[model samples]
Target: MAWKFETSGLDGQCELFGVNIFKYRWRDCRETAAVTDPHYGVEKMFHVYEVEIDGQLRRFAAGEFSNCVWGFYLEQG
Candidate 1:
């Protein structure tokens, strides 16, 4: 089954920072990595996923921030 964007730790809204992430046509999940938050210094765990975007592979982090609060961020090179 193809991975759906709604399950991507992001909401139904695809436009992020004025960019249509879904427009890239994100594909299956490749791998997962564990990471800790650096900004808040709260040491929250995040799951980083490598996925196919626009036919190219890219990384994104997704996890719960607090009680039902979840988010994702495109990994930076």
Candidate 2:
């Protein structure tokens, strides 16, 4: 299913395994996660986001990370 993410901002950032990682909080403050594992020379990163679907909240993570663009994904349980 497609996701609709609210506005987000960087809450923290760090480096691990020589890769830069970032932490962010969603607008609701109930969903948050970090992004790492750069793709295309750090132009693309990966992250998992929690979404509410069918009156239930779920986590999903399936997408690339862009420097100028922010996308959403659900984490696998």
Candidate 3:
């Protein structure tokens, strides 16, 4: 199934790998294995965001692990 992304909210900063990264939330951000077609199945969902590193704003998605939020950067295009 094709993937779809949409911005949900701009929350705040989160620290990862000794640096502060901005947090963004999306409606359909989740683990690849957990997701099916958006119209067909119920899957785990998370928040997506963007961060500025070295003067470049990069996109990311947030997921919860062990009660803490984790950030995963999206590929640049």
On TM-score, the leading prediction is 1
What would the per-residue lDDT of candidate 3 be over residues 27-55, giving only the tens digit for each residue?
44333423222334455544554555666
- lDDT at residue 44 of model 1 (Cα atoms): 41
- Of candidates 3 and 2, the better by TM-score: 3
> For each candidate, C-alpha RMSD in Å?
7.8, 11.7, 9.2
Model 3 pairs in collision: 24-48, 24-49, 25-48, 26-48
For candidate 2, lDDT tens digit of each residue in 1-77? 33333223232333222222243222243434543333332322334444443455545443434454434443333
Measured against the true structure, the TM-scores of the candidates, in listed sequence, are 0.44, 0.28, 0.38
Model 3: lDDT to the true structure:
0.42
Residue pairs clashing in model 2 are 45-65, 59-74, 59-75, 60-73, 60-74, 60-75, 61-74, 61-75
lDDT of 1 by residue, 4-75 (tens): 222232444445434555455444465554444434645444555555544566656556655554555554
User: Could you give the candidate ranking by lDDT, starting with the highest?
Assistant: 1, 3, 2
Candidate 1 Cα errors over 4 Å, as ranges: 1-10, 14-40, 74-77
